[model samples]
Target chain A: MYGKKVKLRIFFFSIIFLAILLTTFLILKSLEENVVYFISPSDVKVLPELSKKKIRIGGMVKKDSIETNAKEILFIITDYKSEIKVSFSGSIPNLFAEEKGVVAEGFLKDRNYFTAKKILAKHDENYMPPEVKKALESKK
Target chain B: MFNIFSPSKIFSITSRATKYVFAIFILIISVGLIEALFLSPKDYIQSDSVRIMYVHVPAAWISLGIFSLIALLSISILIFKNKTFSLIAKSLAPSGFIFSIIALVTGSIWGKPTWGTWWAWDARITSMLILGLFYLMYIVAWRVISPNNANKVTSIIAIIGVVNIPVIKFSVDWWSTLHQPSSINILSKSTIHHSMLVPLIIMTAAFALFSLLIFLMKYNTELIKIKNKGLDRL
Candidate 1:
């Protein structure tokens, strides 16, 4: 009787254990739908489907391309080969400058313009990405 | 006179009592989810995105909490040869990993529109990445090591890795960089509104309880496994 009780307890707990794992996996998979992505300027150009979706385009803000009107700033974002225009009506951070990597979050109304709600600089001196460097060099 | 509640017995009440405990856990978690999801008013600045706070913050807390628990338990097992302690440490690991992943994923969702970047390598974020990596390594270690050899080896790793937790946590503020300082806690300037705060509190409490209950159940299973296999001596 004692042995049977022990076996039953193990059986019950194992079911619970498997249930916990299954629930976690299902929740995680559902959450996966919301995970968004950031695309390079070049990557954005090729994927026609993404043109209608809310997306982020990240690259350097071209020097001399930034224009301002009533504290709202307008600038051109580039992946070296193609340029996308971004306009933002907010105070710019100190790191926000031309020739630095910036990710502009908004949607493309057309293929050429990107209206931005937020902008952030990709700043990490030690962790310079190889691809961005390659992109820069190819332009030269 | 010598019932299940005897001094030596360990909460071995009738199965009906255990059912009640399960019901209480379910009730608390349900209330917590509702409060976190519906009752809490949006942040004045962040609005609905801030709702992510309910799930993200508690998961992050549990991730760190479990790491500490594992580190402490590892220490106890090493210093005292306390078999129960090592078992507890091992049992708590997956819960920690789950919450850590939750924190990372929820953080990304909250950041998508707000931060403008899906992910960043800022101090808090990078350290969090490391924390997540450490979690993976810890799990892999359990799988790779022999059962008899696992305890002492993992203990050393756990103790050494504890230092990284503080580094991951403090790196953001120290750098004067991006990624805002801890919100929903000491560094935040604005107080959370009562409606949102209530659910935040409830969900956090529920998450902690869930983690605890899971830990207990897992711990019990490990004990049984060891006993059945006569590996308790190892």
Candidate 2:
């Protein structure tokens, strides 16, 4: 058996540890509804009645699927299997491009349509742009 | 293990090694700086701003690493009654706190340019902030309590605070985050290009060496103070 001080210390910290664990569990449980996850278009298709809570839909930008008006930009996010139309009024991220990965956050108006509040473009790890790649190829 | 590193031997090695660590730290840091500032390619998307990751990620890694070390040292103190474990933990806390602060500040700076906002309640950010807060609380516990009482109390705090480490590590996977997923992976080929990855690795090495230098200097000072006070031989 350990000394009295070591025993007391362990007991003290065990109480603290349990308290922290309980607090974390309760917080995560309470915020469960808000823990949105990136879902592909096919996942959206399988979802039940849509709620007002915000969610993120992630996939590639379908080629030539972008349409821009004076105010709003409309695009389709595709997972190569299915697609969801996203409409946004705000400016998009710098990395946003056709045929690139993107995740849009907003409420779904329907199974086929998403009214986006934000657009985040995913950048690949490749540092060389196509043009730079071409230039380097020619140099080689 | 405790007797293996006698106080006199620990003092001799640390004093001798400090100069060498300082030299190596300076050399590696210089190379890291050059690579980060000039040699590394900018992100195709984030442009030059991506350079911040070189410092930010490494600082975060160090903060987590040091906290883990402190947790291990605390266990050694509590279970094995290793006399030198508490001193080692004391030596590590200040640097861990500094790294935590650096990680937070640099993360905020990176977030502003990349995320288009200064701060958010994203799970990763929130967890990192909590980790930094724990580091602050650990340092404060050591300072406020009497020396006789502080060792056990701080050890308990360090041991318990380890819960936050896993939270910090898995926060990205557990919740939706504005922060991107990790580019560097241990199990597979990392997503980052070698052009950028080289600098990041160099910076991380530099930071690790710098922490070693700092820990050695701090440990020597703490040991000297203890010796002067006629507390223990070490």
Candidate 3:
């Protein structure tokens, strides 16, 4: 029931669609190398290797562990069970506080040390996204 | 299925529904705003900044949902050669684009307080930005291209753009991003406390009602335009 013109048009559009898909695939493949993986302080302790690639670590800032110096701020991030020391030399976000959840993007200097390139102050500790809260509860 | 109604009948039905939809939208918004802004308890961590979720999440959801609907309708258009499908797609684009922009703007506002920056190239944000761009492209195709060919071309874009839906949905799991993962799961009970979830759910319903009201009005206008074209041909 279809006309020859419609068939020709479909074929023509198919070629264009394939070209777009191929371009998107290539770009994502290249970007995959640069994407950072997020981990908790506890996850870092169990890593098989000291990854040189940048990664993100998220956890609550340990109370009483924050210290400030002339050009740097130091804090300890804890998953309650494990803690890792973090140091940064940049202006911190206003929301950054002790006992608050935060995610830091940086390279792991060693098993015990993390030098954060940027600090992401997470929302209220009670504000666990439903998905995250569910995931956390499921793990428990 | 939609063809069962004459153009005049469609207009009358939509006009009658508009009153109830508008009232519902108003009721929901008033309740949602009060709950979101004043009644809901401040997040233990993010504080009041968590309120932005009421608007931001719904806008993002509507944008994605509209595009997916357009894609589905486009499939019907190709299969059935129905003009009504294209017209409905046309009707949905402006609001879709508007909600997409709102989502981005609200997201940036929300991000500034929590993420330490207004914008980041995180996977979720990047993919959402692309989604907004695709919405603009779809809208532009309808406006600038001739009517004869616009339906075919825009439908093609809609279908192809479906690829981004899964990407946006899975971005949090697929990449490490500053944006938090989706919380309101459909498969299971939401982890959000009932007090907060009530307002969020209400706001989502309000937004959906508003979208439907806009869509109905636009659909009526489109049908009139098509009728005019028929008259001109005769």
| TM-score, one value per model | 0.60, 0.82, 0.80
Of the candidates shown, which would achieve the greatest DockQ relative to the real structure?
Answer: 3
Would you list the clashing residue pairs of candidate 2? Answer: none
Chain A TM-score across all models, in listed order: 0.60, 0.68, 0.63
True contacts kept of 1: 0.04
Total clashing residue pairs per candidate?
Answer: 2, 0, 6
Query: In model 3 chain A, where is the ten-residue run with the lowest total lDDT?
Result: A123-132
Minimal lDDT window, size 10, model 1 chain B: B1-10
For candidate 2, give the lDDT of residue A94.
65
- DockQ score of each predicted structure, in the order shown: 0.04, 0.27, 0.28
What digit string (tens of lDDT, one per residue) describes model 3 on residues A20-138?
Answer: 77877787778784554367888899998997988889889999999999989999999998989999989788779888778888989998999999998865314543455557778
* Whole-model lDDT per candidate: 0.68, 0.82, 0.82
lDDT of 3 by residue, B138-202 (tens): 98999899988899889888988877888888888777666777777788755576777888888
Of 1 and 2, the candidate ranking higher by lDDT: 2
Candidate achieving higher TM-score, 2 or 3:
2
Model 2 bad stretches (over 4 Å): A1-43, A124-140, B173-176
DockQ of 1: 0.04
Q: Over all chains combined, what TM-score does candidate 2 have?
A: 0.82
Docking class of 2: acceptable
